[model samples]
Target: MPYTPVNVSLTLTNQQYVALRTVNGTVVLPPGSSGRPDAGGLKGIIVVRQAGNSYLAFERNCPYRPFDACALVSVDRSGLFLRDSCCNSQFNLQGQVIGGPSPFPLRQYSTSLQGSQLNILN
Candidate 1:
């Protein structure tokens, strides 16, 4: 099956996501931000805190399950795993498949931080 793709360009202000700088943040699409399609960034994005000022963004959909609503992933307890509700698969904050029935890792997007806004694109 083929999945439809949309061009995504989302910007989250720094002050709005200050907590994300130290903690993991996960928002589902279709209802995130302004509740717009692009608000949560495509299927959604998981903003992870890294060393220094670095941050990472990844697609919320599990790669193995593709585009079903059941494929939507979330940040699990311990704030280090992204788990897919459908299959209970687990992925690391970096989109790496840690422990799951899935053979592939989660999809990742590109993120660039400006002075006050964090750009999540591609």
Candidate 2:
């Protein structure tokens, strides 16, 4: 499924600069924390910090039913995978389908880290 192009650039200056949404609005995502900010991709972006300075970015749009409004994927509470309530599809952080009826993996964006700048693109 075609999705809105994503090009997100984040500058990490300190431990409290990363923003992530929560029940009480926005909160800080530490240098190693993973969360969905209220921007980027088709249904927003899920940013996951991997080993060391590496990171992974995935589109929140579920591939099962791309046009469905509820096809958006969110990080499951355990922070282990992404799930779509619309079709009950589950995907790993790498965007591979792990459960449910999804036939395709979540769209992954390319990421490049330069100094303190993290750029995600697709």
Each model's lDDT: 0.65, 0.69
C-alpha lDDT of residue 17 in model 1: 52
> What are the runs in model 1 whose C-alpha is more than 4 Å off?
1-16, 23-38
The candidate that achieves the highest lDDT relative to the unseen native structure: 2
TM-score of each: 0.75, 0.78
lDDT of 2 by residue, 83-112 (tens): 998999998767799999998998878988
Of candidate 1, the 10-residue stretch with the lowest lDDT total is 1-10
Q: Which candidate number maximizes TM-score?
A: 2
Clash pairs (backbone) in predicted model 1:
none
Residue pairs with backbone overlap in model 2: none
Report the C-alpha lDDT of model 1 over 44-108, residue by residue, as the tens digit: 66777676567777767777757676877788866667898798889887788888788988666
Candidate 2 accuracy as TM-score: 0.78
